[model samples]
Target: MPQPQPNLTRRGLFGNGLWAAVVAGITGLSAYLFGRTKQAKTVWQIDPDKCVACGNCATYCVLELSAVKCVQVYAMCGYCDLCTGYLDPDPKKLDTGAENELCPTGAIERVFVEDPYFEYNIKEELCIACGKCVKGCEAFGNGSLFLQVRHDRCLRCNECSIAAACPSQAFRRVPADDPYLLKGAKESKPAGESKGIA
Candidate 1:
Protein backbone atom coordinates (compact mmCIF):
# COMPACT_ATOMS: atom_id res chain seq x y z
CA MET A 1 0.00 0.00 0.00
CA PRO A 2 1.17 3.55 -0.81
CA GLN A 3 1.92 6.02 2.07
CA PRO A 4 -0.49 8.93 2.62
CA GLN A 5 0.66 12.43 1.40
CA PRO A 6 1.56 15.14 4.01
CA ASN A 7 -1.16 17.69 4.76
CA LEU A 8 -0.92 21.16 3.06
CA THR A 9 -1.22 23.40 6.15
CA ARG A 10 -2.42 27.01 5.70
CA ARG A 11 0.46 28.27 7.90
CA GLY A 12 3.09 26.58 5.70
CA LEU A 13 1.56 28.09 2.55
CA PHE A 14 1.56 31.57 4.16
CA GLY A 15 5.21 31.21 5.19
CA ASN A 16 6.18 30.34 1.61
CA GLY A 17 4.32 33.37 0.29
CA LEU A 18 6.03 35.65 2.83
CA TRP A 19 9.51 34.43 1.80
CA ALA A 20 8.71 35.10 -1.90
CA ALA A 21 7.53 38.63 -1.06
CA VAL A 22 10.75 39.41 0.81
CA VAL A 23 12.88 38.33 -2.16
CA ALA A 24 10.79 40.45 -4.55
CA GLY A 25 11.08 43.48 -2.27
CA ILE A 26 14.86 43.20 -2.19
CA THR A 27 15.08 42.89 -6.00
CA GLY A 28 12.82 45.92 -6.50
CA LEU A 29 14.85 48.01 -4.06
CA SER A 30 18.06 47.14 -5.88
CA ALA A 31 16.57 48.23 -9.22
CA TYR A 32 15.34 51.51 -7.73
CA LEU A 33 18.78 52.27 -6.28
CA PHE A 34 20.46 51.61 -9.61
CA GLY A 35 18.13 54.09 -11.30
CA ARG A 36 18.71 56.67 -8.58
CA THR A 37 22.48 56.41 -9.01
CA LYS A 38 22.13 57.23 -12.69
CA GLN A 39 19.68 60.09 -12.09
CA ALA A 40 21.83 61.82 -9.47
CA LYS A 41 24.86 62.16 -11.73
CA THR A 42 27.02 65.30 -11.85
CA VAL A 43 28.57 67.21 -14.78
CA TRP A 44 32.31 67.14 -15.55
CA GLN A 45 34.75 70.08 -15.74
CA ILE A 46 38.47 70.75 -15.92
CA ASP A 47 40.04 72.42 -12.90
CA PRO A 48 42.24 74.95 -14.66
CA ASP A 49 44.27 75.43 -11.50
CA LYS A 50 45.51 71.85 -11.53
CA CYS A 51 45.97 71.25 -15.24
CA VAL A 52 49.49 70.37 -16.38
CA ALA A 53 48.82 70.59 -20.16
CA CYS A 54 49.78 66.90 -20.48
CA GLY A 55 48.17 66.41 -23.94
CA ASN A 56 46.04 63.58 -22.53
CA CYS A 57 42.88 65.67 -23.01
CA ALA A 58 43.44 65.55 -26.76
CA THR A 59 43.87 61.80 -27.03
CA TYR A 60 41.83 60.17 -24.29
CA CYS A 61 38.28 61.50 -24.72
CA VAL A 62 35.71 58.90 -25.80
CA LEU A 63 34.40 61.28 -28.43
CA GLU A 64 35.83 61.09 -31.96
CA LEU A 65 36.90 64.69 -31.48
CA SER A 66 37.64 65.45 -27.84
CA ALA A 67 35.27 67.88 -26.07
CA VAL A 68 38.26 69.84 -24.67
CA LYS A 69 38.87 73.33 -26.07
CA CYS A 70 41.07 76.32 -25.29
CA VAL A 71 39.55 79.41 -23.66
CA GLN A 72 41.05 82.88 -23.30
CA VAL A 73 40.63 85.06 -20.26
CA TYR A 74 40.73 88.44 -21.95
CA ALA A 75 40.93 90.18 -18.58
CA MET A 76 44.26 88.49 -17.98
CA CYS A 77 45.45 88.65 -21.59
CA GLY A 78 48.09 91.30 -22.31
CA TYR A 79 46.96 91.61 -25.94
CA CYS A 80 50.58 91.41 -27.01
CA ASP A 81 51.57 91.94 -30.62
CA LEU A 82 53.65 88.76 -30.52
CA CYS A 83 51.30 86.27 -28.83
CA THR A 84 53.38 83.24 -27.93
CA GLY A 85 50.24 81.11 -28.04
CA TYR A 86 49.61 82.03 -31.67
CA LEU A 87 53.15 81.98 -33.04
CA ASP A 88 55.93 79.39 -32.81
CA PRO A 89 59.10 79.99 -30.85
CA ASP A 90 61.23 82.15 -33.13
CA PRO A 91 58.60 82.21 -35.88
CA LYS A 92 59.84 82.86 -39.38
CA LYS A 93 57.82 86.07 -39.29
CA LEU A 94 55.05 87.55 -37.13
CA ASP A 95 52.24 86.71 -39.53
CA THR A 96 49.05 84.62 -39.71
CA GLY A 97 50.57 82.15 -42.13
CA ALA A 98 50.55 78.48 -41.04
CA GLU A 99 54.37 78.46 -41.03
CA ASN A 100 54.48 81.08 -38.26
CA GLU A 101 51.55 79.72 -36.23
CA LEU A 102 52.16 77.34 -33.31
CA CYS A 103 48.73 75.70 -33.32
CA PRO A 104 48.83 72.39 -35.19
CA THR A 105 45.38 73.01 -36.66
CA GLY A 106 45.83 76.79 -37.13
CA ALA A 107 42.84 77.31 -34.83
CA ILE A 108 44.19 80.50 -33.26
CA GLU A 109 42.64 83.60 -34.86
CA ARG A 110 44.57 86.84 -34.44
CA VAL A 111 42.62 90.10 -34.87
CA PHE A 112 43.89 93.66 -34.70
CA VAL A 113 42.01 95.35 -31.86
CA GLU A 114 44.10 98.56 -32.01
CA ASP A 115 47.65 99.80 -32.51
CA PRO A 116 50.20 97.42 -30.91
CA TYR A 117 47.42 95.21 -29.45
CA PHE A 118 45.78 92.18 -31.06
CA GLU A 119 42.86 90.03 -29.95
CA TYR A 120 43.23 86.24 -30.16
CA ASN A 121 40.35 83.79 -30.35
CA ILE A 122 40.08 80.09 -30.90
CA LYS A 123 38.34 78.66 -33.94
CA GLU A 124 36.39 75.96 -32.16
CA GLU A 125 35.47 74.16 -35.37
CA LEU A 126 39.11 73.51 -36.09
CA CYS A 127 40.49 72.92 -32.56
CA ILE A 128 41.97 69.49 -31.80
CA ALA A 129 42.45 70.01 -28.04
CA CYS A 130 46.19 69.38 -28.37
CA GLY A 131 47.15 71.88 -25.60
CA LYS A 132 50.10 73.25 -27.59
CA CYS A 133 48.69 76.76 -27.41
CA VAL A 134 47.99 76.38 -23.70
CA LYS A 135 51.57 75.19 -23.04
CA GLY A 136 53.04 78.01 -25.07
CA CYS A 137 50.89 80.69 -23.48
CA GLU A 138 51.52 79.49 -19.96
CA ALA A 139 55.26 79.11 -20.45
CA PHE A 140 56.27 82.37 -22.20
CA GLY A 141 53.30 84.75 -21.94
CA ASN A 142 50.45 85.59 -19.61
CA GLY A 143 48.68 82.46 -18.49
CA SER A 144 45.45 83.50 -20.18
CA LEU A 145 44.93 80.49 -22.41
CA PHE A 146 43.60 77.35 -20.73
CA LEU A 147 41.78 74.12 -21.53
CA GLN A 148 38.13 73.65 -20.63
CA VAL A 149 35.61 70.93 -21.35
CA ARG A 150 33.11 72.07 -23.98
CA HIS A 151 29.87 70.73 -22.54
CA ASP A 152 28.00 71.13 -25.83
CA ARG A 153 30.17 68.41 -27.39
CA CYS A 154 30.68 66.36 -24.25
CA LEU A 155 28.82 63.06 -23.97
CA ARG A 156 28.88 63.35 -20.18
CA CYS A 157 29.77 59.72 -19.78
CA ASN A 158 29.24 58.10 -16.40
CA GLU A 159 33.03 57.96 -16.13
CA CYS A 160 35.03 60.30 -18.35
CA SER A 161 37.93 58.59 -20.09
CA ILE A 162 39.93 61.80 -20.28
CA ALA A 163 39.71 62.38 -16.54
CA ALA A 164 41.07 58.92 -15.87
CA ALA A 165 44.05 59.56 -18.11
CA CYS A 166 44.90 63.01 -16.78
CA PRO A 167 48.29 62.83 -15.05
CA SER A 168 47.59 65.91 -12.93
CA GLN A 169 44.09 64.73 -11.95
CA ALA A 170 42.78 68.10 -13.11
CA PHE A 171 39.30 66.96 -14.17
CA ARG A 172 36.53 67.30 -11.62
CA ARG A 173 32.76 67.54 -11.24
CA VAL A 174 30.89 70.81 -10.81
CA PRO A 175 27.29 71.77 -10.17
CA ALA A 176 25.18 71.62 -13.27
CA ASP A 177 24.02 75.17 -12.66
CA ASP A 178 27.63 76.36 -12.81
CA PRO A 179 29.58 73.72 -14.68
CA TYR A 180 32.40 75.73 -16.16
CA LEU A 181 35.70 76.10 -14.24
CA LEU A 182 37.11 78.92 -16.36
CA LYS A 183 40.50 80.28 -15.31
CA GLY A 184 39.44 83.92 -15.20
CA ALA A 185 35.69 83.73 -14.80
CA LYS A 186 36.38 86.07 -11.94
CA GLU A 187 39.01 88.84 -11.77
CA SER A 188 42.64 87.73 -11.96
CA LYS A 189 45.96 89.36 -11.10
CA PRO A 190 47.75 91.66 -13.56
CA ALA A 191 49.54 89.85 -16.39
CA GLY A 192 52.69 88.05 -15.24
CA GLU A 193 52.07 88.92 -11.61
CA SER A 194 52.22 85.21 -10.84
CA LYS A 195 53.07 82.09 -12.80
CA GLY A 196 50.84 79.87 -10.71
CA ILE A 197 47.55 78.86 -12.37
CA ALA A 198 44.19 79.94 -10.88
Candidate 2:
Protein backbone atom coordinates (compact mmCIF):
# COMPACT_ATOMS: atom_id res chain seq x y z
CA MET A 1 0.00 0.00 0.00
CA PRO A 2 1.29 3.55 -0.81
CA GLN A 3 2.18 5.79 2.09
CA PRO A 4 -0.34 8.53 2.87
CA GLN A 5 0.31 11.62 0.67
CA PRO A 6 1.51 14.73 2.46
CA ASN A 7 -1.52 16.97 2.79
CA LEU A 8 -1.47 20.58 1.52
CA THR A 9 -1.40 23.10 4.34
CA ARG A 10 -4.28 25.62 4.54
CA ARG A 11 -1.84 28.46 3.80
CA GLY A 12 -0.57 26.64 0.69
CA LEU A 13 -4.11 26.03 -0.53
CA PHE A 14 -5.10 29.68 0.02
CA GLY A 15 -1.97 30.95 -1.74
CA ASN A 16 -2.49 28.68 -4.75
CA GLY A 17 -6.16 29.64 -4.93
CA LEU A 18 -5.33 33.33 -4.80
CA TRP A 19 -2.71 33.03 -7.51
CA ALA A 20 -5.16 31.22 -9.83
CA ALA A 21 -7.84 33.83 -9.20
CA VAL A 22 -5.42 36.66 -9.97
CA VAL A 23 -4.29 35.01 -13.19
CA ALA A 24 -7.86 34.36 -14.29
CA GLY A 25 -8.88 37.97 -13.61
CA ILE A 26 -5.99 39.33 -15.64
CA THR A 27 -6.69 37.02 -18.57
CA GLY A 28 -10.37 37.94 -18.60
CA LEU A 29 -9.58 41.65 -18.58
CA SER A 30 -7.10 41.28 -21.43
CA ALA A 31 -9.49 39.30 -23.57
CA TYR A 32 -12.35 41.72 -22.97
CA LEU A 33 -10.21 44.71 -23.92
CA PHE A 34 -8.75 42.98 -27.00
CA GLY A 35 -12.13 42.04 -28.39
CA ARG A 36 -13.62 45.54 -28.24
CA THR A 37 -13.26 48.11 -31.02
CA LYS A 38 -11.82 51.35 -29.69
CA GLN A 39 -13.86 54.20 -31.07
CA ALA A 40 -11.92 57.42 -31.63
CA LYS A 41 -13.28 60.26 -29.54
CA THR A 42 -11.61 62.96 -31.58
CA VAL A 43 -10.86 63.96 -35.17
CA TRP A 44 -8.13 65.88 -36.91
CA GLN A 45 -8.83 69.56 -37.69
CA ILE A 46 -6.91 72.65 -38.73
CA ASP A 47 -6.65 75.74 -36.53
CA PRO A 48 -7.25 78.53 -39.01
CA ASP A 49 -5.62 81.17 -36.86
CA LYS A 50 -2.46 79.16 -36.42
CA CYS A 51 -2.22 77.87 -39.97
CA VAL A 52 0.23 79.55 -42.31
CA ALA A 53 -1.25 77.93 -45.43
CA CYS A 54 2.06 76.14 -45.96
CA GLY A 55 0.61 73.98 -48.83
CA ASN A 56 1.16 70.72 -46.96
CA CYS A 57 -2.58 69.97 -46.75
CA ALA A 58 -2.79 69.73 -50.56
CA THR A 59 -0.24 66.95 -50.93
CA TYR A 60 0.35 65.03 -47.71
CA CYS A 61 -3.10 63.53 -47.07
CA VAL A 62 -3.32 59.75 -47.54
CA LEU A 63 -6.19 60.08 -49.98
CA GLU A 64 -6.51 60.73 -53.73
CA LEU A 65 -8.26 64.00 -52.90
CA SER A 66 -7.09 66.02 -49.95
CA ALA A 67 -9.77 66.66 -47.32
CA VAL A 68 -8.49 70.16 -46.61
CA LYS A 69 -10.45 72.88 -48.42
CA CYS A 70 -10.57 76.64 -48.56
CA VAL A 71 -13.58 78.03 -46.66
CA GLN A 72 -14.90 81.57 -46.78
CA VAL A 73 -16.08 83.63 -43.84
CA TYR A 74 -18.58 85.77 -45.68
CA ALA A 75 -18.92 88.12 -42.73
CA MET A 76 -15.25 88.90 -42.98
CA CYS A 77 -15.21 89.22 -46.76
CA GLY A 78 -14.72 92.66 -48.30
CA TYR A 79 -16.60 91.68 -51.51
CA CYS A 80 -14.36 93.84 -53.67
CA ASP A 81 -14.40 93.21 -57.45
CA LEU A 82 -10.61 93.09 -57.43
CA CYS A 83 -10.38 90.28 -54.87
CA THR A 84 -6.75 89.55 -54.20
CA GLY A 85 -7.61 85.92 -53.51
CA TYR A 86 -9.50 85.47 -56.80
CA LEU A 87 -7.25 87.33 -59.20
CA ASP A 88 -3.53 87.15 -59.84
CA PRO A 89 -1.61 90.24 -58.75
CA ASP A 90 -2.22 93.05 -61.26
CA PRO A 91 -3.96 90.80 -63.76
CA LYS A 92 -4.63 92.11 -67.26
CA LYS A 93 -8.29 92.48 -66.23
CA LEU A 94 -10.66 91.54 -63.36
CA ASP A 95 -12.75 89.30 -65.63
CA THR A 96 -12.81 85.54 -65.01
CA GLY A 97 -9.84 84.31 -67.05
CA ALA A 98 -7.74 81.24 -66.39
CA GLU A 99 -4.49 83.16 -66.69
CA ASN A 100 -5.79 85.97 -64.47
CA GLU A 101 -7.14 83.69 -61.73
CA LEU A 102 -5.07 82.87 -58.70
CA CYS A 103 -6.53 79.38 -58.29
CA PRO A 104 -4.70 76.89 -60.48
CA THR A 105 -7.74 74.60 -60.59
CA GLY A 106 -10.06 77.62 -61.13
CA ALA A 107 -11.96 76.65 -57.99
CA ILE A 108 -12.98 80.21 -57.12
CA GLU A 109 -15.96 81.73 -58.96
CA ARG A 110 -16.46 85.46 -59.29
CA VAL A 111 -20.16 86.16 -59.01
CA PHE A 112 -21.63 89.54 -59.98
CA VAL A 113 -23.35 90.69 -56.79
CA GLU A 114 -23.41 94.36 -57.83
CA ASP A 115 -21.21 97.02 -59.34
CA PRO A 116 -17.64 96.96 -57.94
CA TYR A 117 -18.68 94.10 -55.62
CA PHE A 118 -18.37 90.46 -56.61
CA GLU A 119 -19.16 87.55 -54.33
CA TYR A 120 -16.33 85.04 -54.43
CA ASN A 121 -17.49 81.49 -54.15
CA ILE A 122 -15.40 78.34 -53.89
CA LYS A 123 -16.13 75.46 -56.17
CA GLU A 124 -15.62 72.79 -53.52
CA GLU A 125 -15.70 69.85 -55.92
CA LEU A 126 -12.97 71.33 -58.08
CA CYS A 127 -10.82 72.63 -55.21
CA ILE A 128 -7.45 70.91 -54.72
CA ALA A 129 -6.73 72.29 -51.21
CA CYS A 130 -3.68 74.07 -52.65
CA GLY A 131 -3.79 77.03 -50.20
CA LYS A 132 -2.64 79.39 -52.96
CA CYS A 133 -5.83 81.41 -52.70
CA VAL A 134 -5.76 81.28 -48.92
CA LYS A 135 -2.23 82.65 -48.80
CA GLY A 136 -3.19 85.43 -51.17
CA CYS A 137 -6.29 86.30 -49.17
CA GLU A 138 -4.40 86.49 -45.93
CA ALA A 139 -1.59 88.53 -47.42
CA PHE A 140 -3.49 90.96 -49.63
CA GLY A 141 -7.21 90.76 -48.83
CA ASN A 142 -9.33 90.73 -45.69
CA GLY A 143 -7.98 87.35 -44.52
CA SER A 144 -11.45 85.88 -44.86
CA LEU A 145 -10.40 82.68 -46.62
CA PHE A 146 -8.76 79.86 -44.68
CA LEU A 147 -8.25 76.11 -44.77
CA GLN A 148 -10.33 73.51 -42.92
CA VAL A 149 -10.72 69.74 -43.08
CA ARG A 150 -14.03 68.82 -44.68
CA HIS A 151 -15.37 65.86 -42.73
CA ASP A 152 -17.72 64.89 -45.55
CA ARG A 153 -14.73 63.68 -47.58
CA CYS A 154 -12.23 63.04 -44.81
CA LEU A 155 -11.34 59.49 -43.84
CA ARG A 156 -10.66 60.53 -40.23
CA CYS A 157 -7.40 58.59 -40.15
CA ASN A 158 -5.83 57.50 -36.89
CA GLU A 159 -2.80 59.54 -37.79
CA CYS A 160 -3.25 62.31 -40.34
CA SER A 161 -0.32 62.66 -42.76
CA ILE A 162 -1.11 66.30 -43.47
CA ALA A 163 -0.98 67.09 -39.77
CA ALA A 164 2.47 65.56 -39.49
CA ALA A 165 3.75 67.51 -42.48
CA CYS A 166 2.23 70.82 -41.29
CA PRO A 167 4.98 73.37 -40.65
CA SER A 168 2.79 75.58 -38.44
CA GLN A 169 1.50 72.84 -36.12
CA ALA A 170 -1.96 73.98 -37.14
CA PHE A 171 -3.39 70.49 -37.30
CA ARG A 172 -4.78 69.06 -34.10
CA ARG A 173 -7.44 66.70 -32.77
CA VAL A 174 -10.83 68.17 -31.90
CA PRO A 175 -13.76 66.60 -30.11
CA ALA A 176 -15.71 64.28 -32.38
CA ASP A 177 -18.97 66.00 -31.46
CA ASP A 178 -17.52 69.30 -32.69
CA PRO A 179 -15.20 68.27 -35.50
CA TYR A 180 -14.77 71.71 -36.98
CA LEU A 181 -12.80 74.59 -35.45
CA LEU A 182 -13.90 77.22 -37.93
CA LYS A 183 -13.32 80.93 -37.74
CA GLY A 184 -15.83 83.14 -35.96
CA ALA A 185 -17.63 86.22 -37.33
CA LYS A 186 -15.68 89.08 -38.85
CA GLU A 187 -15.66 91.01 -35.60
CA SER A 188 -15.46 88.11 -33.10
CA LYS A 189 -16.99 84.76 -32.19
CA PRO A 190 -17.92 85.62 -28.60
CA ALA A 191 -14.73 84.09 -27.24
CA GLY A 192 -15.09 80.30 -27.60
CA GLU A 193 -18.12 79.88 -29.77
CA SER A 194 -17.57 77.34 -32.55
CA LYS A 195 -18.52 78.64 -36.00
CA GLY A 196 -18.98 77.08 -39.43
CA ILE A 197 -18.32 77.95 -43.06
CA ALA A 198 -21.12 79.67 -44.94
Candidate 3:
Protein backbone atom coordinates (compact mmCIF):
# COMPACT_ATOMS: atom_id res chain seq x y z
CA MET A 1 0.00 0.00 0.00
CA PRO A 2 1.21 3.57 -0.89
CA GLN A 3 1.59 6.14 1.96
CA PRO A 4 -0.65 9.27 2.03
CA GLN A 5 1.02 12.56 0.79
CA PRO A 6 1.31 15.46 3.33
CA ASN A 7 -0.92 18.54 2.68
CA LEU A 8 0.76 21.84 1.47
CA THR A 9 -1.26 24.54 3.26
CA ARG A 10 -1.19 28.35 2.59
CA ARG A 11 -1.19 29.03 6.40
CA GLY A 12 2.07 27.06 6.83
CA LEU A 13 3.76 29.05 4.02
CA PHE A 14 2.52 32.34 5.54
CA GLY A 15 3.90 31.42 8.97
CA ASN A 16 7.36 30.57 7.49
CA GLY A 17 7.40 33.90 5.60
CA LEU A 18 6.58 35.85 8.76
CA TRP A 19 9.39 34.10 10.71
CA ALA A 20 11.89 34.88 7.91
CA ALA A 21 10.85 38.53 7.96
CA VAL A 22 11.35 38.74 11.74
CA VAL A 23 14.84 37.24 11.54
CA ALA A 24 15.78 39.55 8.69
CA GLY A 25 14.59 42.61 10.61
CA ILE A 26 16.60 41.57 13.67
CA THR A 27 19.77 41.05 11.62
CA GLY A 28 19.39 44.44 9.92
CA LEU A 29 18.99 46.21 13.25
CA SER A 30 22.07 44.48 14.68
CA ALA A 31 24.17 45.49 11.66
CA TYR A 32 23.12 49.12 11.98
CA LEU A 33 23.98 49.23 15.67
CA PHE A 34 27.37 47.60 15.10
CA GLY A 35 28.21 50.11 12.37
CA ARG A 36 27.30 52.98 14.64
CA THR A 37 29.54 51.62 17.36
CA LYS A 38 32.46 51.37 14.91
CA GLN A 39 32.00 54.88 13.53
CA ALA A 40 34.83 57.33 14.24
CA LYS A 41 34.02 59.85 16.93
CA THR A 42 35.55 63.27 17.58
CA VAL A 43 37.28 64.32 20.80
CA TRP A 44 37.47 67.59 22.70
CA GLN A 45 40.65 69.66 22.43
CA ILE A 46 41.86 73.08 23.53
CA ASP A 47 43.10 75.73 21.12
CA PRO A 48 46.35 77.02 22.61
CA ASP A 49 45.82 80.59 21.39
CA LYS A 50 42.26 80.72 22.73
CA CYS A 51 43.13 79.25 26.15
CA VAL A 52 43.28 81.96 28.83
CA ALA A 53 45.13 80.00 31.53
CA CYS A 54 42.09 80.30 33.79
CA GLY A 55 43.17 77.48 36.19
CA ASN A 56 39.87 75.72 35.46
CA CYS A 57 41.59 72.89 33.61
CA ALA A 58 43.22 71.67 36.79
CA THR A 59 40.13 71.96 38.92
CA TYR A 60 37.27 71.07 36.56
CA CYS A 61 38.53 67.83 35.05
CA VAL A 62 36.72 64.68 36.22
CA LEU A 63 39.95 62.67 36.41
CA GLU A 64 42.05 62.68 39.58
CA LEU A 65 44.96 64.00 37.48
CA SER A 66 43.82 66.41 34.80
CA ALA A 67 44.45 65.46 31.18
CA VAL A 68 45.57 68.98 30.31
CA LYS A 69 49.31 69.62 29.98
CA CYS A 70 51.50 72.59 29.17
CA VAL A 71 53.22 72.33 25.78
CA GLN A 72 55.99 74.67 24.61
CA VAL A 73 55.93 76.17 21.13
CA TYR A 74 59.64 76.21 20.33
CA ALA A 75 59.25 78.51 17.36
CA MET A 76 57.53 81.12 19.51
CA CYS A 77 59.87 80.60 22.46
CA GLY A 78 62.53 83.26 23.05
CA TYR A 79 64.64 80.89 25.17
CA CYS A 80 65.49 83.68 27.60
CA ASP A 81 67.64 83.17 30.63
CA LEU A 82 65.14 84.95 32.84
CA CYS A 83 62.11 82.91 31.77
CA THR A 84 59.10 84.05 33.75
CA GLY A 85 57.49 80.63 33.21
CA TYR A 86 60.35 78.89 34.98
CA LEU A 87 60.74 81.10 38.06
CA ASP A 88 58.39 82.49 40.64
CA PRO A 89 57.37 86.15 40.49
CA ASP A 90 59.92 87.21 43.07
CA PRO A 91 62.73 84.72 43.35
CA LYS A 92 65.62 85.12 45.76
CA LYS A 93 68.05 84.37 42.93
CA LEU A 94 67.91 83.91 39.13
CA ASP A 95 69.02 80.30 39.36
CA THR A 96 67.69 76.84 38.59
CA GLY A 97 66.85 76.03 42.19
CA ALA A 98 63.87 74.13 43.57
CA GLU A 99 62.92 76.97 45.92
CA ASN A 100 62.75 79.51 43.09
CA GLU A 101 60.76 77.23 40.77
CA LEU A 102 57.32 78.55 39.84
CA CYS A 103 55.75 75.16 39.13
CA PRO A 104 54.48 73.48 42.28
CA THR A 105 55.33 70.10 40.77
CA GLY A 106 58.69 71.22 39.30
CA ALA A 107 57.44 70.02 35.89
CA ILE A 108 59.41 72.57 33.87
CA GLU A 109 63.03 71.57 33.33
CA ARG A 110 65.57 74.23 32.37
CA VAL A 111 68.51 72.96 30.35
CA PHE A 112 71.59 75.14 29.86
CA VAL A 113 71.58 75.63 26.12
CA GLU A 114 74.05 78.53 26.05
CA ASP A 115 74.82 81.89 27.64
CA PRO A 116 71.69 83.98 28.20
CA TYR A 117 69.55 81.17 26.76
CA PHE A 118 67.94 78.16 28.43
CA GLU A 119 65.93 75.34 26.86
CA TYR A 120 62.71 74.77 28.76
CA ASN A 121 60.74 71.55 28.49
CA ILE A 122 57.67 70.31 30.34
CA LYS A 123 57.78 67.02 32.17
CA GLU A 124 54.31 65.76 31.32
CA GLU A 125 54.30 63.15 34.11
CA LEU A 126 54.77 65.83 36.78
CA CYS A 127 52.43 68.43 35.22
CA ILE A 128 49.25 69.37 37.09
CA ALA A 129 47.74 71.61 34.35
CA CYS A 130 47.25 74.33 36.95
CA GLY A 131 48.05 77.04 34.35
CA LYS A 132 50.31 78.79 36.87
CA CYS A 133 53.28 78.61 34.50
CA VAL A 134 51.13 79.61 31.52
CA LYS A 135 49.89 82.71 33.32
CA GLY A 136 53.44 83.75 34.15
CA CYS A 137 54.64 83.09 30.62
CA GLU A 138 51.89 85.06 28.93
CA ALA A 139 52.26 87.93 31.37
CA PHE A 140 56.02 88.39 31.10
CA GLY A 141 57.25 86.40 28.11
CA ASN A 142 56.29 85.66 24.46
CA GLY A 143 53.42 83.33 25.42
CA SER A 144 55.28 80.29 24.14
CA LEU A 145 53.87 78.04 26.82
CA PHE A 146 50.21 77.02 26.49
CA LEU A 147 47.88 74.36 27.81
CA GLN A 148 46.51 71.53 25.64
CA VAL A 149 44.43 68.43 26.26
CA ARG A 150 46.81 65.48 26.20
CA HIS A 151 44.70 62.98 24.28
CA ASP A 152 46.83 60.05 25.36
CA ARG A 153 45.83 60.75 28.96
CA CYS A 154 42.33 62.06 28.21
CA LEU A 155 39.32 59.84 28.87
CA ARG A 156 37.43 61.28 25.83
CA CYS A 157 34.24 61.63 27.82
CA ASN A 158 30.99 62.27 25.97
CA GLU A 159 30.73 65.54 27.84
CA CYS A 160 34.10 66.78 29.01
CA SER A 161 34.00 68.43 32.43
CA ILE A 162 36.87 70.79 31.63
CA ALA A 163 35.14 71.99 28.46
CA ALA A 164 31.91 72.69 30.29
CA ALA A 165 33.76 74.81 32.87
CA CYS A 166 36.21 76.54 30.54
CA PRO A 167 35.93 80.30 30.85
CA SER A 168 37.47 81.17 27.48
CA GLN A 169 35.41 78.56 25.61
CA ALA A 170 38.67 77.24 24.25
CA PHE A 171 37.41 73.71 23.89
CA ARG A 172 36.39 72.40 20.47
CA ARG A 173 35.73 69.03 18.89
CA VAL A 174 38.47 67.80 16.55
CA PRO A 175 38.87 64.72 14.41
CA ALA A 176 40.23 61.77 16.32
CA ASP A 177 42.85 61.13 13.63
CA ASP A 178 44.38 64.64 14.03
CA PRO A 179 43.33 65.84 17.47
CA TYR A 180 46.12 68.28 18.33
CA LEU A 181 45.94 71.97 17.44
CA LEU A 182 49.66 72.63 17.45
CA LYS A 183 51.24 76.05 17.72
CA GLY A 184 53.34 77.72 14.98
CA ALA A 185 51.95 75.42 12.30
CA LYS A 186 52.31 77.13 8.89
CA GLU A 187 49.01 75.94 7.42
CA SER A 188 47.24 79.07 8.69
CA LYS A 189 48.44 82.61 9.43
CA PRO A 190 48.80 83.98 12.98
CA ALA A 191 46.08 85.99 14.75
CA GLY A 192 46.98 89.42 13.32
CA GLU A 193 48.48 88.42 10.00
CA SER A 194 46.62 89.09 6.76
CA LYS A 195 47.42 88.99 3.04
CA GLY A 196 47.74 92.77 2.56
CA ILE A 197 49.00 93.62 6.10
CA ALA A 198 52.69 93.62 6.95
Give TM-scores for every candidate, taking all chains together and pairing residue i with residue i: 0.77, 0.77, 0.74
Put down candidate 3 lDDT per residue, 52-155, tens digits, no spaces.
Answer: 99899998888898999999998899998889999999998989888999999999999988898999999999999999999999999998899989988999
User: Candidate 3 has what TM-score?
Assistant: 0.74
For 103-162, candidate 1 gives per-residue lDDT tens digits of 999998999999999999989988888999899999989989999999899998877899
Order the candidates by lDDT, highest first: 3, 2, 1
Q: After superposition, how far is residue 48 of candidate 1 from its true place, in Å?
A: 0.5
In candidate 3, which residue pairs clash? none
Which portions of model 2 show Cα errors greater than 4 Å?
Answer: 1-40, 185-198
Best by lDDT: 3
Better of 2 and 3 by lDDT: 3
Q: What is the C-alpha RMSD of each candidate to the true structure, in Å?
A: 7.5, 6.6, 8.0
In terms of lDDT, model 3 sits at 0.85
- List the pairs of residues colliding in candidate 2: none
In candidate 1, how many clashes are counted?
0
What is the C-alpha local distance difference test score of each model? 0.83, 0.84, 0.85
lDDT of model number 1:
0.83
